[model samples]
Target: MRSSSPSPAPPVDLAKARRVAVEAAEAAGDLLRAGMARPLEIRPKGTAGDVVTELDLAAEALILRRLRAVYPGHRVIAEESGVNEGTGTAAGADAGLVWLVDPLDGTNNVAIGMPVYAVGLALCAGPVPVLGVVHDPVTRRTWSAVRGEGARGPDGAPLRLAAAARAGRADNPVLAWTQGHEVGRGDPVVLPLRTAVEARCGRLLQLWAPLVAWVMLARGDIDGIVGYRPELVDLPAGALLAKEAGAEFRALDGGPYEPSIDLPPAERGFVAARPALLERLLETTAQACRPAAAGTGSTGGTEGTGGSAGAGGSGGAAQGGRVRLTR
Candidate 1:
């Protein structure tokens, strides 16, 4: 990787792109919803908990078609279908743009008739996510956000948590936990971190469906999210959504989260919460990751906003936001 910060990306018609992404995600979600009640040809993608169904493939194809039809020059990465190098790549070299898609984010839940699932998509300019759209066909709700813009729900209004919801109750905090597929149950770093957080929080939820958990966090239904090396495919969209919804996505070392499509798995985990709850979340994170950071654990390295993280400056508000909303 280059040892220098990336130059600023030129502005584009991101509003139009956001519309296209929202449409694609919703359409794919509709497909998933329609197929949910039917018998699925489910198969293991890898570990026992990870699975894929025919609906996942169908939904991905539906979303990919909508996306390619609009931006054929942009790179497209989908969960089920292979990457479309087209005129761009995830490296953002050709067109300096990439789209990340997870047409059915909760395939395991969907396979088992669980009502929690969503269709997710994101647009990245170089390494930074500029737009994100996540749709839940079951509830017919869609959440979207542009990099500098605030997050929005299906009603097209900014998503703001009530004061009570934003408060992280010291005695009853609820948190969502996410882990990458590669991290085994016995992972040294994850096991310790998970144990620590679980002990403190009144309730700990690990949905395996990260996008769903992200929505819960963004909407302030949960206190925070403690992701232990989440997948890149699901990270860009959900992280953008939460950040725009007046929440912060911070590295375990308390550095600002400047996500890149190129970071190593060890660098991808984070803690997300509204500012009111950030310090507490960070305190928990620091305590949990202290041992891991001393070794070769997933979240060991100190993260810089530039250089290896592929950012030139802070990509957050008021310096980094566009569609600003008062907290």
Candidate 2:
């Protein structure tokens, strides 16, 4: 005789996923570090000066094999190979658990022997990520975060987001900037925003290596990161890490980045920072968002005095089509 009731769904094991991410990233990083000494093929990936090397393919293959072996029912979206769909029960679920992988996040830098590449691996239950891991092969440094459990560093210590922010007493904070290739280098909106932020900051870095920037932000090495229409694959994991470390990750419209569990990825342009800096960041964003007058080229200007960017909420960015995806 067969059982009458259907079997209960297996629980999503985030701890296991986090462990896998760490191992896979480290493994991929080892391969990437080795490949750096003897690289053969490199090709242009996009118009925005992105490149893909043979190392990228090798690392992705290694990661996919490890991930598939463990969670055969999980979907994966890797930078080199694109999306590989899942099978069996988890595939048919409404939320769709997925792994977003950037096998060689700083491929161009690696190709040039800059030694700044990393392996980014993340697991998400729909748009909300359960964990994120970034591993720097050269330095052997790793930053990881488990949602609701807090973020951790390579030394296995919890990140001191607030204490670190307080310790840094620089009048002008250093900031990292990230934008998708689709946003255009000279985009009118981005230009003014850049000009405004750069004018006030001690420095505004455009590393061309965004995952590195994300790690820096999570580690509190930089004050904040401002992004305009960043990539989906790289965004969620980084955001989760930063948020878990007590940073606020939200939209440029002064709104909460309320990700939908069953919907596609939707974290657009954002200001990610500690609480003390959140209001000021949002103020500057609002000031920058104002329409530029005729013929001044939207250059630099006086920054906002400072105020909370609480609860403004993307103001129809969803319904009014203000926020857009990179793809």
Best-matching candidate per TM-score: 1
Tens-digit per-residue lDDT, 1-327, candidate 1 = 111234345345877988898888888877887787678897866432456778877888888788777777677766766466544342243366778888777766666777777778988876678788888888989998877667888899988654454344656788888766545545557777777878878888867577887788778888788876566677778888887787766887687777666665567768887666777778878887877766754463332221101001011101111211111
lDDT of each: 0.68, 0.65
Give the true-structure RMSD of model 2. Answer: 9.4
**Largest lDDT belongs to which candidate?**
1
- Candidate 2, residues 51-132: lDDT per residue as tens digits? 6778888998999999988888787877767667776665565235778787776666666777766788888765557778
Worst 10 residues of 1 by lDDT: 308-317
- Using alpha carbons, what is the TM-score of model 2? 0.81
**Candidate 2: misplaced stretches above 4 Å?**
1-10, 88-90, 93-95, 163-169, 258-267, 292-327
Name the weakest run of 10 consecutive residues (lDDT summed) in model 2: 307-316
Collision pairs in model 2:
none
Q: List the residue pairs that clash in candidate 1.
A: 148-322
List candidate 1 segments past 4 Å from native. 1-11, 47-49, 87-94, 162-170, 297-327
TM-score (all chains, Cα) for each model: 0.84, 0.81
